[model samples]
Target: MSIARARLAVIIVSYCNADDVDRCLRSLARSDLDQFEVLICENGGEAAYTNLLARLVGPDRILKRISNDSDVLDLPQKRLASVASCRFQARANVVRIGLAIDNLGYGGGVNAWLEPLLSVPDWDAVLVLNPDTEVDPRALSELVAKSAAGYGMVGGNLVFDASPDKIINYGLHWSRMTGRVIAIGRNAPVGSTPSAENLAKIDAISGACVLATRACVEDVGLMAEDYFLYMEDLDWGLRRGKHRIGIADKAVVRHIGGTTIGSAVTIEKRSDLSIYLSARNSILYARRFAGWRWICHFGIGLLYAARYLIRGSSSAGKVALAGLLDGVNGKTGRPKVVPGAR
Candidate 1:
């Protein structure tokens, strides 16, 4: 098949959002292109949804990327660039499902499941979609077209899946003073740049939905699995900074974030694994790619975060401080593997 006709895979790394996964697959099934394949990596599920999905989509449309993910979390390290060994099927767009298996955290899980399809000879691009999302009909087309035009990776406006009016991510802006990261920009309208260049110039878009080219993988390498979950997208963006590629406004997606963490995040409290990971990962991100600027970036970030935690933020504070010390001390320790931690 021609490059244009080459299959574009969608990797859906699921955790516990069964209802959201159902909605996500339903949207994908209703897509204009029915030829694309779906790969469900059922990592750690009490009730396996892949079987139900296979029944709904029929076996042919669903490619079982991993059989009986009995101990999907057995070897976390194995999920990294190490899993890039499985080959892709011809003319097939494999959408990896990682729900019932071990939680590869964020980066590890996504990279692990996608290894199969990215191995394909004619595979052109892979779209990573969070499970709690309702994708726009033209999102796939926009991403593929732009990537083909020489933009290696692209991102788009993310409307909140719950409330479409308020955008979840409309690109990102780096605050010079507060050193805080902001999502969504004013004067948002969709189209290519004035020069008709393909890549989106936005500083940082949400990973809730991203369309990445094969060359981007070759150039930047895979997502850093060291971070169990948070900041993987920022790391990816930082890597692309080396090559000057970035988000594409043309690729539009709607996202429902924080599903992997827990619905408890909706509460006002700021102490938990969710908050802990965010605090820890921020420091981890600084150590890996930021060099000296990390000091300024994270210092301001700590102050901004302190405003949130105010009185009850001691748990996250301790985790963040510990992680920062570990990072600066040249340890950069891996997260202590909790037996059932995803």
Candidate 2:
């Protein structure tokens, strides 16, 4: 595929954050690349759906809701009634909005929007970005350039939005022994540059900003929904078949980090949902890819629970234990219990 001139689809999954989505879209409007369409999956229900549409379309203009057998997709007849609509309408395309029937998590939300477009021949690549990120003007262009160079999957440099001088990660490094995933170049100075040779050796690309060729996506299939929240990116990188994954160093994205699930660098700031799903998904990852080492991964999960308990966070400890039990018992999909204050 001649990706340089090939049109791509940008998929953003938003949950109860219209303001962030608005800001993200405005940033995309300043991007150098214009051959792309935006697909948004609103997983936060009716109120969120309405608020987002209001922000994008203004109070007077209403977008019509189009429902199919599977889910609700809202597509406006014309371009969005906003100043930032030019980028979306560059190819005479209206932004496609998907209202998820339920909270489909990250991977499921992405798959929801992608399933319909699987047969569409217009786009050659799909860029999955979190709605909380703001891309630099050249970021999209850089990603397309890398994709054109033959990399099947690509990611950008993610930095903390609050402190742009600090780094989040170029990609990720997953360890099979402890079932732990570490962010490469995490907390390093923003000026630090990693060699392309090093960037190609990562275990997985960060999910915050991943661009996969349509061929790669079709080959590897949809991301596993069993994880529901975390680890799906790693799973994708692991199951990428013959495709190669790399990082586009010039593509920079400012990330507000984890707001939807209340995840933070510290355990004290993490929400119950973040803690639980991460623990449960690690075991699931192990069971699928760790072979006989799956037992060791379970042990690691137990240790994580004990560590939480020992650290004097009983609520988090209990949540981790619940996740470990669910993981070992072969539970999958969304969590059965609602994750809130215990």
Candidate 3:
């Protein structure tokens, strides 16, 4: 199909960030496309649902109250109960908001939406976008164009929102020996493109902005819920059987990276949740994919936890150690202990 006629479904997993969702939807409205829909899973529970409703509908009651179950939309009525459908910011895009029963992490939140829509033949491609991003007007078109050319999975150029002129990643580089995943072309000039060799080495597209064709989704299945937060994107790429991945350089997205988890380039600045999940998932990833290299993965995880201690982030250090232990025990799904859970 041609890019102009391609039906796209944009999926966003939101957590306590209705304002960010507002911005993201506004940017999406500028896309130069004829047909598209957005599916959002508000993973922050009841309070977040109210906030999202207030932000999207104001006081006019464009959509009915949540507890009034009779008013709910029936698009994905299986596991979820109060999924609501509405249009935001006067756009033609059909926005469906699914309320999560609990905090389902990133993967589960996305699955809440994808599981219901996979069989729906309306959408040609699915673009998983972070709620904190603002896309260039031409970005969606470029991605659909690449999808039309038969790329199973595609990623666009991501730049830091703080400094839009500097690139955050062209894609990602994974080290099997050390269990480290690094962004290719990180902090490089925005206009710079990676060499073909560098692009070929990309282990996976960063989860921040990944576009997967419907067939690819069918082949790989939904996002893995084992890791919950980090490393699942790489896991998805590793499991892409026979499907090819490509990059659309013209598709630019400005990302306000790590708003929910407090992730940062420097270890000292990362939140406890971010540190723990990163450390835990790295080991989990190695256990799944790495052969004897799992030992190296453990060593690297230990060093990372130690770095947090040495850098004086004692809380983060403790969390990282706990996560490593949980990972070693093959614990998966939502963590037992969470930030401020006490």
Candidate 4:
């Protein structure tokens, strides 16, 4: 399919981040792409959704002034008025918002929003994006262009929101020997001179912003629900056998990493939830794909715990150890409390 004719749907799963959702919607309103639809799955319940609506559609007019045409989308009748449509010349594009009754985690929230759209044949591709991201004007267009060229999955260059000049992730590199997943182009400075090597095939793309064709989703399936948050993208990528994964260098996104889950900059400040999930899911992913190499993955978890203990981060150490044990014991889903919390 050609870029102009291809139908695109963007899904953003947000949890308790009204400001971030507002910013993301505003950025989408300014996109260079002629037409597309956006769905914001607010997983923080009715309160967060109310705050988000105020920010996006309030008298302040944070989003661009756009006409809401009734026939733009055949959304559920109850929330049809909530869908924002922009009249760009003769074409009407849509922006729909919905609320989850509870916190559904990242993957569950996305699936909840996406399951309804799967029956609609209008969209040719879906872009799953984080609320804590701002896409460049050309980002969606470039991603769609790659999808048209037959790449099943595609990602944009991701830069830190605070340090836009520095690259945070181009994609991911997974190692079978050590059962490790590493972000490519991490902390690399964006050079004044552009390099052809910027575009390449990658093992996996960051879940923060990725585009997938309808055909790919049908074949490989949706994001795994086993991982409440972390490693779900990696698992999806691994399952997409032999399908090409492309990194579009021109498509840039500024991401506020760990906005919902705590910062990685400081050990103490890191959220117990983030540390626990990362440790638990890494082991689960390895067991699913690495065969006998799963032992190495378990050992890596031990190393993380040991390092945390050595650094006097007892809480983080305890969280990691607890996560490792849970994964070994085949435990999954959200924990009742913060792992290792008394």
Model 4: per-residue Cα lDDT over 45-153, one tens digit each: 7777778777666445554335443342434323222343332223345566767656777887777656766765667889999999999989899899988898999
lDDT of each: 0.55, 0.78, 0.80, 0.76
lDDT tens digits, residues 1-342, model 2? 012223888889889998888888778867888687678888788778778877776433322322222212233212211112212322333456667777888898888777766855667899999999999999999998998889888987789999988889888877888888888888777756767766755877888999999999999998788798999999988888788877677888999978888888688998888888988888888888988888988898899889988998988988988887778787888887843336
TM-score versus the correct structure, for each prediction: 0.72, 0.87, 0.91, 0.88
RMSD of each: 6.6, 5.3, 4.0, 4.2
In model 1, which runs have C-alpha deviations exceeding 4 angstroms? 1-6, 45-101, 173-179, 186-201, 241-251, 263-271, 309-334, 337-342
Q: Which is the better candidate, 1 or 4, if ranked by TM-score?
A: 4
What does the lDDT come to for candidate 3?
Answer: 0.80
Q: Name the runs in model 3 displaced over 4 angstroms.
A: 1-6, 59-73, 338-342
TM-score of 3: 0.91
**CA displacement after TM-score superposition, residue 15 of candidate 4 (Å):** 0.4
Q: In lDDT terms, which candidate is top?
A: 3
How would the candidate models be sorted by lDDT, starting from the highest? 3, 2, 4, 1
- Tens digits of per-residue lDDT, candidate 1, 1-342, equal 111223676777766555666677767755655445444454444354444344334335322343322322212234422221111222234333334345566676677756644554666776777878876666677667767777766766677555655555555544444435566543334443322221243555467787777777777778777777667777776677444344455555667677666534432543355555665566566655566676776676567446545757554555555544544454432356321122
lDDT of 1: 0.55
Q: Model 1 Cα displacement at 70 (Å)? A: 23
Identify the runs in model 2 with alpha carbons over 4 angstroms from their true place: 1-6, 59-93, 338-341
Query: Compared with the true structure, what per-residue lDDT tens digits does model 3 show for residues 152-180?
Result: 88888899999998889988877988988
